[model samples]
Every structure is written in structure tokens, then in C-alpha cells.
Target: MITGAQLRDAYISASNLIGNEKQKVDELNIFPVPDGDTGTNMSMTIASAAREVSRFEDGGIGQCASIAASALLRGARGNSGVILSLLFRGFAKGLKDVTEAGGQQLADALAIGVEAAYGAVMKPTEGTILTVARVAAEEGKSAAVKGASAVEVWEAMCEGAHRALAATPELLPVLKKAGVVDAGGKGLTLILEGMLSVFQKGIVIPSENVEEQQPEVSVKRAVAEWEGEITFTYCTEFIVGRGDQKAEEDAKNLRAYLESIGDCVVVVDDDEIIKVHVHTDGPGNALQEGLKYGQLLTVKIENMREQKRRAEEEAAAAKPEKQRLERAEPENDVGFVAVSAGEGINGLFRDLGCDQIVSGGQTMNPSTEDILEAVQAVPAKTVYVLPNNKNIIMAAEQSVELADRKVVVVPTRTIPQGLSAMLSFDPDRPQEENLLDMVRAAEHVSTGQVTFAARDSEYDGHRIKEGEIIALNNGKLTFSEKTPVKAVTKLAKTMIKKDSSFVTIIYGEGITDEEAEEARSVIASKAGDNVEVTMVNGGQPIYYFILSVE
Candidate 1:
């Protein structure tokens, strides 16, 4: 049995371990897309739990496990983050209401978390986190049955996780093609090794040499003195963890919870976790309630009014200094950053309160360094990042570690999800509550897109020819047609299904206005009478049309 402090230290150790080797894990991402962010996802996910575990008040092993579990869930960002959160959540459940956890309980907890993660995903895929976690839990269970101690069980789990991680490439051809293991799986193994490190060796803070912080401005400045023209204020941020309760509509319920607290909220939900952001007055209460569902991590708050006032003063001062375009020094309060592409998309994110936008997409993936600069540029107590593309999630995640201030990333896999997530923005709401709520709301949306095939392949029994327009429901290619409009219409029809009530079509660049309108009409006809259709100009490249259903 371990003490609460020991558990806390173990989590911190795990975080540092994963943080140190994030790039290696990132390299394992199978997708050739520039935004492969497996390492970043896992690191951010564990970091959320690490923050909670590090700050746990003196308590028994159960308390520590509970805290770690909650924090992991709330801080979960992508598929990887969500899975990591579940592993700990299961650990908490295994040790619930107990003073200390022995090897048996720990093993049980590991198994439980694995089950929870598998349960959450709509379609469980092997060769991913699920495989790594399942193997580790099994090893832990087998070791515990042999009268092993907690440390012994964890060691078994660590070894098992590594073994499983190593085998990921064998299980998935893409991983083999990419010449790497599963990024997310390796990340989980790193965390387990980190936990084991504390028990075997000792807590070792990542050296400043390796754990670099974003460079800070040389001079100290007033909180309200740095802004200019206050493009946006209220740099609100929080970390949310997953809750243990097996409640129906957990995501939807979380969304309702955030709605009660704030507005301007954006929530993105994946199989494993949810990421959220909002503008509201109750950042503290939001975080407190967020704890009920998960653990509390780092937080940041800024006064929007103060930011505006400072920006005005700076703008006035710059005029006297004869500075044209008035250098918009980063504010000292709050700031925002997002990952996106296209002028229209950038403008949309900016209008939604983002302070910085990193240009990226399916083709042009941003590197970790690009995202890191954006994170560092946002001069605030906390910085919020939105990785609107699944491929970019890892890169955006890596930026958090390189940043100086608190950083929370909302994993938005698609532009529709990104925009919908921001709709619930509430700077005043508690960060945790908003995060949970917005993420839940995002899950309600269904996404579709039309793009020309990049390669010839047989997917889901559909034969595709390169250069032909392909329509996708979510990420799965469903239709291949000669014209963009026909392909897009087919995707929109699939997106609506029977229950969908609203349909949105975002026309991209290279598409004529008449073609977009024609595509919309096809979807309208298929959607029946009650479904409403709305169209907009995204002016994005690549995809001919981005369709969304709610």
C-alpha cells in the first residue's frame, strides 16, 4: 500500500517521464499528415492528471487515486487523452472508498480503466491505446494474483504496456508503413514507466535543460499595460478530468451543466475525452464543479475589461511614440491560440475569440515548433489551444510543454466541430464546467466532407479512383462520384440520416457559387421537410465542401 503523497509523486514522475520523451512518441503517429500529434496528446492527457495528483491534499491512497482519475478525465484532449483518463478512472474505482490500495486493487483498477476506455469508443480498434492498456492490466492482474505488491504489479503493467506498444506496428499496417509504434500507446507506456520510476528509483524533476519553458519578456509589466486594441479579452482557461459516475448522457449532461454557467462556449468530444472553453465570470466555481467530474489542474483567469482598458492606453501611447500599426504587445491577462487554415477559417477563429492562429490542415501540418511559438506568444495566465484537425492535435499538444503559462487544448477534429465548440463560449463560467459542457455539445454534431481522392484504394468495399471526387461521412469514404457536387450531396445525405434536424454546408475554394447552391439543394431534397439547410463560404482549400449535421 502507498500513501497519498507517494501516489501524487508517482503521477508527477510519470508526467515528467512522458514529457521528456514526447517527441519520440510523436514520431510514432501513423498518419503521414503533418499534424500527427500522438505524443502531444498523451503528454497533455497525463499532464492534466499530473497537475491534480501533484496537488492532492494529504489523504490515503484512495483519495490520491480519485484525484488523479478525475483530473485525467477532464484534461483529456483527443482519443489518446480520453483513453489515458479512463485508465486512471478505473484505477480510482478499483480503490474507491479504501484507505490504501494493494496489488490486487491496483490490478483491478487497471483492468477497470481499460474496460472503461474500450467501452467509450464507438468502434474499438486493436493496436491502439486499448491494446496497450488491456495488456498492461492483464499483466498487472496476473502478477497481483501471485501476491505481488503494488509496486510489483505496476512494474508488470509497465512492462506489459511497453510490450504492447512495441507490437502496435505489427497489428496495424499503417503503423508499419509509418515505421513507428503507436504514438498513443507508447505515450501510455511512458507514463507507466514514469510511475514505476518513482517506486523503483525516486522522483526526478525533469531538468530545466530538457524541460524547456517558453522565453518570457525581459521587463515586468502591469497586468493592463500590454494590450493594444484589445482584439479579444477574458483569456479564460481550465482543465477538466473524467468523472467516475456511470451516468447516462454524460457528455450531454456536461454540456447542460456548462450552459447553466456561461456562454461563448466551444466543446469538442471524442471517444475518450472532452475538451471545452467558454467566456464567463465564474472561473473558480467552474473549476470547483469541474472537480466533481474529474480532478482540478492548472487554471488561468484575466479581466476582459482590464484588457480593453490596457489596449486603449497602449494604442494611445503608441500614437504619441509615432509607431504605425501600434505594436500589439501581448496582454498580461488572458490570451487565445488556435490551429487552423485558410483566410476565412483564420478569420472565423479570430472572430470566435482566438488571439493566434497557426496555419495548418490535412496537407500542411504544423510542426511542434510552430504551435509552440503560438502558445508562447499568448501572454496570459493560461493559454487555450484548439487543434481543429485530428492530425494537428499532437502538434498542438506538444506546444503546451514548451509553453511557460498554463495551457489547455481543446481537441477539435474538424472545422464544424471547431466552430460548434466555440458557440458555447463563456468567459465567466467555471473552466471545468465549460470544458465539459462544450465538449458534450460537440458530440451532437455529425461531420461530412467532399474531396478528390489522393490515391486509389478499396475502402469499406468502395473502389475509388485517384482524382475522382470522394464523399466521406466522418472520416470514412462512402461515395465516389465524377463531380464534386454529386459527391458532396451523397455525403450530406449520409450525414442527415433520420434524426438529424439541421444541416450546414461550408463551400470551399475552387467551388463555384452555383455548384455550392446546387449541392445544397440536393441535400435539402434528401433531408425531407423538417431539416433546415444553411450554407456558408469557408474558402478553404482541398475539400470541395464541408457538410455538418446536428
Candidate 2:
């Protein structure tokens, strides 16, 4: 049987291992489109659980699994993250109400997780994480049937996952053509290995490579260990009212007392109050020591191990939080939440009646919680979410179950598609009827993009070199060009049909207005007098121009 402590350490190890090596998995993506990194998304999703579960001390397997599943679902960031959450959600169900799990129970849970993951995907594909997970679960079940130990069953699963990962190239032609295994599958395999290490050796994988910025302060602070036994359990803080006239002179001795009992010690001696922050196993003892100086005014104590990663997250979230727009209560019958980046593109969505705009797109995919928050903020009985990027669609879909009000996902795969859907939405029409119209409108519009190659690669028979201009038609690589202007103009002419009536050139940042107008003129001159050609500044990164054709 696997104890709660064992499982908790295993989960933390998996999160840390994946988090530290996300960049390596990111490089396996051959597609030039700058979508969210699969490894990064998966790591963040599991780490959300790690942050929560780390706070629990010897919680039952059932309770820990439940907490992990809930956190994973809310924190899911992309298609990969959503799938990861689904897998864990199923795992949690299998282990429900159990303090510890035997080999058979663990194997059954793995099988259950695999089933849920497959069910969640609309068009479940082979040669992906789903395949790897399925094969691993099968191996685990086989090991359990042979009466193996819990650790033995997990080791078998890891071996099976690695084997499945190796075979992914043969199952997915894209991975084969790129000479790389499936990125998502590779990420899953890594997590399994990470967990196996802990199950067998009782050692959490260290995240030493993970950088933690040490801010210079007058007080000394120590970070909790990422692996092995944590030096301190509680992070205690308090304020003591000074009771003596010699409190200022005694402050030096107070600081010394805190250092003796804790690793991270901060004691600020003031004329009136002495503020202290320390990490120690004995919180009551520390408080007692503080009382000798004066009376305790305010006290706070937390698990220090959980604070390490959370502190890094707080620092990372600072910029996005400041940039995030405030959401409002529902005021209309239907409200829209669209995911996009850049001021201009966000403005376009906001102008189109989007009640809230989530700051994400190809560069970043917002978590399910992010979308859910936006959906709840809308002051409407019925809310519609526009993912606006194909990679973000699954994450947006997960929000449907979490949102309080009626939430609908339009399934828009591009910024242009999102805009077309918004234009098609008729407030006067029935909400359900408008959804069909919006989908149809989005389907009718063609999306063309001109962006630089993220890396050197051979895709769809096109040999693309890094830094070279590339054009894509509805998300497929078309051709390469010498300049952004030439690429946009050529792409426009190709996408325009004889029945086409309008063309809009949305120029991104780094592209001059002269170049945009020049491309518009060329497109207009070729498109004939009947086709209306217009241009706007999108100010988006990665893509030089986003062309919308109808």
C-alpha cells in the first residue's frame, strides 16, 4: 500500500521535475505557430495541485487526490493541461475514500484516468499523451495481476510509458516527419518517471535548476528544500508590543534568539512594536521567546515548504495581475469573454461587445480559472466564451463546467474567426440560434497570417529557416518570403476567391503603416474594384499581419 505521505512526495516530485525542464519539451514542437508550450501548461496545472497538497499534512489518499483533481481542472492552461486535469480527475475517483492504496487499486486508478482523458477529447488522437497513458495503465494492471508491490506496479507503468513514447513517432506522421516524438506524450512520460523515482527511492526530484530570485533585504531568509526532508515546517510571523524602555537595546538579543530557533529569521525592533518572521519547527516556542520581549500582538504561521514555489509564482504573477483588466457583473442578457493579446486586438473584441477580455492568445493560453472568472464577471444570465485560438479551445471548454451562469464556447480558432463570430452575433435573435450563426460566420471566414519562422524546419514540404518570413493559410504553412510586405500581399491574393467581397489587413507591431498600406494597395489592385480592402493596426506580436477574408 502507498501511504498519503508517499503519494504527496511523488506528486511534488512530478511537478518540480516537469517545471524545471519544460523548455526542453517545448523545443520538440515543430509547428512554427507560437502557441502555449505543452510542457509548461502541464507543469503549471500539476503544480497548482502541488501548491495546495503541500499544505496538507498526512491527508488521506482520497482527500489529496480530490484536492489535486480540483486544482488541476481550474488551473488547466491549454489543450494539454485540460487533458492532464481530466486524467487526474478520473484517478481521484478511483481512489476516493481511501487513506492508502494497494497495487491493484493504484493500477485500477491509472486505467480509470486513461478512460477519462480519452472521453474528454472531442477527436482523441493516437500517438499522444492519451496513448502513452493507456499503455502505461495496461502495464500497471498486468503488474498488479502478478501481485506486485505498489512501487513495482508504478515502475512497470513508467517503463510502459517510456516505450509508448518511443513509438509515438510511428503513430503520428507529423512527429515522424519532424524526427521527434509527440511533445505531449514526452511530457507525460517525464511526469511518470518523476513519480516513479519517488515511489521507489522515497526521494522527491530536486528542482535545483529552477531559479528563485533572492531579493536583498536587511533580514535573512532561507528557501525550503525542493527535495528530501524540509528543514523547517512552519513559517511564523508576529508583532510584539515593547514592554521595556531598554527594548531598543534588547532588539539585538531578540534577533539573535530568533536565529537560534529558525532558518529564515527577521526581527525588526521598533520603539513601540517588534515585528518578527521566522521558519521553525516549534512555533509555540518561538512565540514564547517573543513574549519575553513583550506581549504578542499579531501572529501568523504557515507551512514553509509550500511557500517556496508559491513565492516564485507570486513574483511571476505580479506583471500579469497589473495588466489584467477588471471584470464586471452581468448587465446584459448575453455577455462575451474573448481570449486575445495586444491592446489593439483586445480593443476590437471589447468594441464588439465582449464583456471581458482574457489576456492570452498564441503567446499564452489562459487557465480555465481565468476564463471562469471572466465568465462569472459578466453581468448576464447567459455568457459566451471565445477562445480565439485553437490551442486555447480545450482550456476554454473546461470553464463550462466551472462557471456559475450558462456558458457557451463559440469554438473560434483564430482572431479573425473570433471577430467574424462577434459580427454574426445578433442580440435580437435567440441565444441558441445566434450560436449556429456565429459558428457558420466563423467557418465562412478565411484566416491568413504572415510571421517569421520560430525555428528551422521542414513542414508540409516547405523548408523553413529561422528568422525567414513565412505565410500560413488557415493555420497551414504556405510559403516563405523575403519580406513581411511580400508575404502578406502574396497570401492575400491566394486566399481571395472570385466571390470574396471584403479583405482586412490587420498589421501587427514592428510593421510600419507604409508597408501595411502598400500591401493593401497591392491586394486592392489585384482584388478588383468590387472587393473592399481595409487596414488596421493590430499591434500583436509574432504575426506581422493577420488577414481576414470573406
Candidate 3:
């Protein structure tokens, strides 16, 4: 018999197992859209249920499964998350009234979950999580039909899952090309392994990461978010030894003093030590007050303003573009929505008359929903989207279907192409002519990038190593260099032609001012006097420099 308590613990173990190894699953992605977040999405999807189930003390499987299904549906993040939620929803439905499930019941539940997952996807493909789940469920059902125990059914499911995962590449050509199994399949196998460990061995796998500071962190964030304006700049914490009979009086006075200088004050004391946590403008004064009680054992100070700024940046990245774009009814003739990564790059698009700029590029590709939100933010009859990165083009296209107003996606695979398209747009011309001109303008421009290799791999006969400086011409790896500065010059020279009229060097965040000037001088001298050389601070991430030749 399978109990709700065991299932709850099994899922918790699975969540942690996948969360700890998400990066590995992410790396298995061989697709052009290289966000590689399948593991993270699956882990987060299951974690939603795990967190909710942890709160309930009920041992009834029906009640526990219902709560988990509701939580998973609400918390599902991406495509993978949605599929994971669907599978669990089916599991809940199959075990609706069953408190303690037998081998047959468990097997039937697995089959139902697999069926629901397959039905959820519009065009279900093989060699994915669906395949893994389907195979596992079938194996479980087979074992159950043969009069196997619940433990035997689960073991068969795990065994079948591993076999299916290994065969995923054979079913998907892209996986074979990339020499990796499907990321979603791998994620499912890990989850099953974690669950099997608990169901078979009665041992719940512990997470390496401990949430020791979760309570304090929640309190800090709650107070920070509620206060529109931060009154205190620093967050200070200290622990002091309790000296003599006067320690309690000093601790009481310290609390009062902290309350006067800070908004959130927490002073806890025992017979041996006095612990204090406060947000204040002056950390020095806070520490000095703590010293009066006894010798300070531990002292920590953090700038709240900096932390808040970082939090805002992360929120911007997660939600939508950082630019202040207001949603309005379609009133104007036409507007533009450009996707870019850097602050300087976004500013350039804004200056070029883009109504909204979506924050995204390469590895951090924004979702279709994010692109649609940016499109809706524009107050134009027709909105044209320029996805600067190749990975973002598909998402930008997807937004066209959901947008309230007319959305025409001009597939700009690179930043330079997007800029060229922006430059070529003319209000005097008709919409069709303007679109045609933009596409042609993008086609004429050539793009070169200097970036570090993310991982070591043998691609196109080139033995690439991680951390190696690499150059890409148009979209293919041209060469590798020892240094960023050297790679910039090498790639620029390779891209420059005798008839090329303009060379624009867009330097990113990590490139120093001196390095930019050095590259500009070398390219200017090397490309010769006829071709004009110019440099601008792009402030982008990933690539050190983006060379544009026209």
C-alpha cells in the first residue's frame, strides 16, 4: 500500500534532487533557443506542490493530492511547468477517492497522468518527458497486471524511465546531433530516482542547501516592500556576550536606542549572549551600542539601498522590460517594440523611436507573454517587433497572435540587423514598403561577435574549450583567440571589405574604455583609411564587442 505521507516525502526529495542539478539538465539543450531552463522549470513546478504539502498534516492521499494539484496549476512557470502540472493533475484525478493505493491503483494512476500529459500538448512529440512518462507508466501497469506488489511496480517504472531516457536521442535527431538526451526526459528520470529512493528505501534525500536564514530573509523583504521609501540605508546585525547583572538593562536600553534610529528592530537575549538585528542609517552607531553590553562576538553590516537596487533589477528581468511603457488603446499609426539586453542598447532603440524595449537576448530570451505585454504597452494601431537575438525571434512571432493590436514581427536575428532595420524605417513610405526596406537594410549589414565559449565541445571540427575567447561571423564560429582585445581586432579585420563604407564597434560591459580605444585604433589602422571606424558603449552582457560592417 502507498500512503500520502510517503508520497509527500517522495516529492519533496524529488524537488530538491532536481533543484540541486538543474544546471546539468539545462546544459543538455541542443536547440537554437538556448535558454536551457527545463530542469529549473520542472523543479520549480514540483516545488510549489512540495511547499504546500509540507504545511498539511493530513495522511489522506485524496486530500494531499488535491492540494498539490491546485498549487502546481497556479505556480506552473513555463512550457515544461505546464506539462508537469498536467501530469500531476491527472494523478490527483485518478486517486480522487483512494486514500491508500494498491499496486493496480498506482499503475492506473500513472497511466492516467501520462495520457493527460500527452493530451495537453498540441502536437505531441516523441523523445521528450512525455515519452519517458509513457514508458514508465506502461512498465508499471505491466508489472501490476502480473500480480506484482506496489514496490515492484514502482521499481519497474523507474527502470523503464531510465531506458526511455537513454533512447531519447535515437528518437530525436537534434539530440543525436548534440550528443545529449532530451533535457525534459533527464529531469523526469532524476525526479523518479528521488521518489524511488524514498518509496523503496524509506530514506528521504536531504537537500545540500539549508534554509537557515529563510525566516529572517522573509521578514526583511516584507518590510522593504511595504515601505515605499527606505528610511534606513544599512542593515546591521550583531551578537554580544552578556557581561554582569547590568547586561539585561543594557539590552533593554539598546533595544530602545535601536528603535529610535531604525524602523525594524529585533533584540533577543539569553543568559550568555544578546543578539540584535536592526536596519539603521548608521551601522557604526549600532555596533558601538552593541559593544557597551559586552565584547561583540559577531558583526554584519549590509547596504539596503544596494540590495533594493539589485532586487529591482532582477524583478525587471523576470517580469518585463525595465523601460516605463504604459498600456494604452491603439491610437497612433504605427510603433516599434525592440528586444535588447544592455542599458545602452535599450537606450539606443528608445532614441530610434521604439515605443517599448523588451529586455532579452541569447541565454536570457524573454517568453512570448513578456513580448506580448511589451507590444500591448505601445499605443499604436500597428506594432512592429524587432527581436535582436535569433533565440528571441520565435517568441516575438508568437506574441503577434495574442496581441490586441496588429503586430508584425520583422525577424532581426542580431543586434546590428535590428539597428539597421530601425535606421531604414521611413514614415513617408507605405507600411509594405517600409517593411520591405527594413528587411533589405538588415540583410545588407554583417555582424561579428566576440564572446567566451560557454562549454567545451567539438563543433564543426573545431575543438572549443570553455572560457576560450571565440569569434562568430554572421552565426558561425570563425575562430578562437587568447584574449578579448586580440579577438576583437581579428574578427573586425576578417569582416572588413575593401568596398565596406562603415565599421561600427559596439563595446559591451566588461570592455574597459582603454581597451575600446585600443581596438578602435587597431581596426582603424588595419581596415585602412578609406573605411570609417566608429565605437560606441553598448553595455551588453555575454559578448565583449559586436562588430557591424556595412
Candidate 4:
């Protein structure tokens, strides 16, 4: 049986392991685009649970799991994080009211989590975290039925996860071509391994690796005062979802109007919306100006002086509470937070047992402020943040010092690796063991992606034209073709060399099911007999297909 204390230790260990292996996870990103980040997302997802576990006085295993599940749900940022939270939620329900659970109970809990994860996703697919988790849980259940101990059953489960992960390439041609396992599947294995380590050994203090940081700003003070006195007390911002009006025209008009009223006027527009940032005395006038173009989706006005005064007062009053809180006896657990962008990807992480999600990606990077809000929202003593996108990693790390919760940032740079790292997590093991396991799994992946060129560009000695299909290996352009299927096959072949066993292709927006099947057939022919191939609907924007190898 595993006690609540053991479960707590396992969570802490998992977070640490994710943090250590984060870089390896980042490297597995399929795109060179600044947004490829999965390991970071998984790490952050689990951190929410870790932080929640840290908040309670020694509680039963069930209580800790419940708290972790709840915290993960609200703190979830991206697709992976949200899914991860769902998995834990099922686990919590399965372990309900129990101070501890035997191997049989744990197996049941794993099954429950798997079911919940599947339920959360709109369309479940093979060759991903869902596959790895379902297979592993079945193995665990079988082990338990054979009268294995909790440790023994979990070990079997990990082995099963490894096997399933290795098989992902066969199921998905992209994975086979990339010569890497499913990134999300690999992450799930790491989570299980981390938990196993806690059960087998004691908690180990994490080694310090000084992470670089942006210049720390006391944003928590809620205000900045200048000696020159406040010319404008409020910072106002609004986003208008584009209607029939052209963004450029709207931006031009908004800019001209803001220039007349505000000194610091910033207006930016994207395909979907226009964002206006300005320092103004009258926020109403700024908002009124926005109404000319379209519907306002979001609006914010911050009173600099009032915010500062309140922050200062709150900090002063909370000093004693903070001191007492700091002196409280330490617990053995930690939690994580992640950011993701899609439903399928979200479900993949949840099935692996992530604690939270921060919804964002490519076209939009969650501000440091958004990440900070998630960190504070998680009810844990210590939380880890994963900014899966390389661009967001710095922003995620920036939230650590600002957070009252002890925060660790694992820089996972891609969705695939982020999912792989979470699969590596385990709640039954010591911290060091789990951390090492997660890191190892993340390091073992190679990722590839297939997309179309936004414009013609001649670089890296490859002649490229607008509308050409392109394939990338860890961010570098490898091939360009006329057809999506041919481009996908070429990319897969480039990635799946000797020793390849599995391949997975996740098709995205605008791709029809018939087209995806055609692409699959081409992949199957090239995959050879030893390899398996499969396809899925990622339903994401931008890229047409994401491939993985193992």
C-alpha cells in the first residue's frame, strides 16, 4: 500500500525530475517556430498539484489527490495542462476516502484516470499519451490481479508504458520517421517512473542549476511611482475582435485618436483582433474609441497609484503571516503547471495526470502576468511552471520570484516533449529518482513537423516558394514539395531511419479525413513491415501535420 505521505513525496519528486529533464524535452520540439514547447507545459501542469499538496497539514492520500485535482483544473493553461488535470481528477475519485491504497486499488485508480482522460477529449486517437496510458494501466491491473505489490504493479506499468511508447512510431508514421517515441507518451512514462522512485528510495534534495532571469520588477507592488509625479494614473487596454472593418484601417483610426488623447499609445493588430495599449487619465474615452471598429472582447484598466498603495499595505499586513507560513513544518510534495493550445493535446496530457493548464501558443503567448495568475491560483506550497514554447519559457520563469508560492520553471520547448515528460511522472517514488526518469525519457525523442510556407524564401541553400509544402526536423527545413502527402512522406523518411519502429501523424486544420488517410497509406508503404503507422486529427491552426518517431 502507498500512504498519503508517499503520494506527497512522489508528486514532489515528479516535479523535480521534470525540471531537470526540461531541456531535453525542449529539444524534441518539431518546429523551429518560437512556440514549440511541450516539456515545459507538462512540468507546469504537475506543479499545480505539487503546490496544492504543500498547502495541507499531513492529509490522507485521497485528500491530497483531491486538492491536487482541483488546483490543476483552475490552474491549467494549455491543452496538455487541462488534460493532465483531468487524469488526476479521476485518480482522486478512485482513491476517495482512502488514507492509502494497495496495488489493486491503485490499478483501479489508474484505469479510472485513463477513462476520464479519454472522456475529456472530443476524439481520442492511438499512438499518443492516451494509448500509452491505457496500455500501461491495463498492465498495472494485470499485475495487481496476479497479486503483485503496489511497487511491483507500478513497475510493470512503467515497462508497459515503455513498450507502448516504443510502439507509437508504428502507430504513427511521423514518429517512426522521426526515430522518436510519442513525446506525450514518453512524458507519461517519466511521471510513473518518478513516482516509483519515491517508493523505492527517500526524497533527495534537488541540485541547484542557476537559471537565467529577466530583470526582476516588483509588479506585485501593483504600482510604480515616479519622482516626477503621476501624469497618468491608469493604464488602459482593450482587445476588439475584428468585425467587417479591416484591421489596418481600424488600427490607423484608433492610433490617430489615441495619439491625440494619450502620450504612450500602442496599437497592434493581428488577423483576428486589434489590441490597444495606452496610458490615459480617462479609460472611458479609450474604450469609446475602440467601439468604432468592432466588439470589445476584453478590457482592463489599472489605477497605478491605488494599486501601488493597496499592494504596499497588503504586503505590510501579510509580513507576519508570511513569516509564520515560512516557519511551518515542511511537507513532501510539489505540483506543476503547463500551457497548451488544443483539445486533443489537452486530453493527451490529462490522461497522463497533469495538474494544470494555461491556454496559449504560437499566435499568442500568455503574458508573464497570465502565468503569474495561474501560479497564485494553485493551492500548493511549491509549484513548477512549464512554458512549453521557447518564447514563453522566459515569461514563465519570470513568474517564479513574483509568486508567493515557491516556483520552479522547466523550459520545455515543444508540445511533444512536454507530453512525454508528464508520462514520466510517478507519485509513489522519491524526488530524485522520478526527476532522473522524466529527464531520461524527454532526452530520447526526435520530433518533425509538416506545414506550408507562408511566403517564398531562399535560405539554407533550399529554393522555396510561397504555398510550398515544407517539412522540418527540430526546427530546420528539410524538404519542400507540391503535395501535402508527398511532403509528409518525405519528412517521415527523413526522420525514420534505421532502428525506427513507430510513426504518428496528427493532421491539423483544413485537412480532410480522406486526405489524411491517403497520407497514411503512403507512410505505411515506406514504414516497412517492422513499423506501424497511424493518423489523427490534431485540429490545430497553422501546421497541417505533426509527426513523431520512436
Q: Which predicted model would earn the best lDDT?
A: 2
Model 1, TM vs. native: 0.49
Ten residues in sequence with the least summed lDDT for candidate 1: 213-222
User: Which regions of candidate 3 are displaced past 4 Å?
Assistant: 1-15, 27-161, 168-180, 191-327, 367-369, 393-410, 424-445, 497-501, 528-532
lDDT of 3 by residue, 1-550 (tens): 8787777767777777887787888878653323427776677777777777755555677677778887776555456666777777788888898888778888898889899889867689999999999999999999999998888898999999999999999998767877999988898888888878777986666665554111111114422332223568887888998767454487789999999888679888888888898889988998888888888888888787777666555544655545545678999999999988888888889899999888778666565657788899899999999988765664566566567899999988899999999999999998899999999999999999998887776666577877888888998888899988999999998899879999999999899999999999999999887999989899998889999999
CA-only RMSD, every prediction? 22.8, 9.2, 13.4, 24.4
Question: What are the clashing pairs of model 3?
Answer: none
lDDT of 1: 0.70
lDDT by residue for model 4 (1-550), tens: 8877778767756666765675666555433333435666666767666656643546688987888777666555345555566677788999999988889988899899999889867678899888988999999999999999988888888999999988998998766755666767777777777778877664422413323110111122212222112357777888998877774677888899988877567788987789888767889999998988889999988886676566556545754642111222224366767777777666666676555677776645665557777666666676666676655665575566567768777657666667666777777876667667666665565677777765445546576776778888866888787877778888888888788777878788778899899888988898899888867677766677878676
Specify the highest-TM-score model's number: 2
User: Sort by TM-score, best first: what order?
Assistant: 2, 3, 1, 4
Error of 1 at 243 (Å): 64
Model 4 ranges off by over 4 Å: 204-360, 363-550
Taking all chains together, each candidate's TM-score versus the true structure is 0.49, 0.82, 0.57, 0.44
Query: Which stretches of candidate 1 lie above 4 Å from their native place?
Result: 205-550
Candidate 2 lDDT tens digits, 1-550: 8877677777778887887778888888888756688888888888877766665566788888888889999999888898889888999999999999988999999899999999988889999999999999999999999999999999999999999999999999988999999888888887888788888987777664534112110112332233433567887888998866544567788778778887757777768898888778899989998888889999888775566556556655663543444456557788899998878899999999998888898868889988988888888989989999988999988988887678999999999999999999998999889999999999999999998888788888988888899999999999999999999999998999999999989999889988888998999999998899988899988889999999
Evaluation by TM-score, superior candidate among 2 and 4: 2
lDDT of each: 0.70, 0.84, 0.80, 0.70
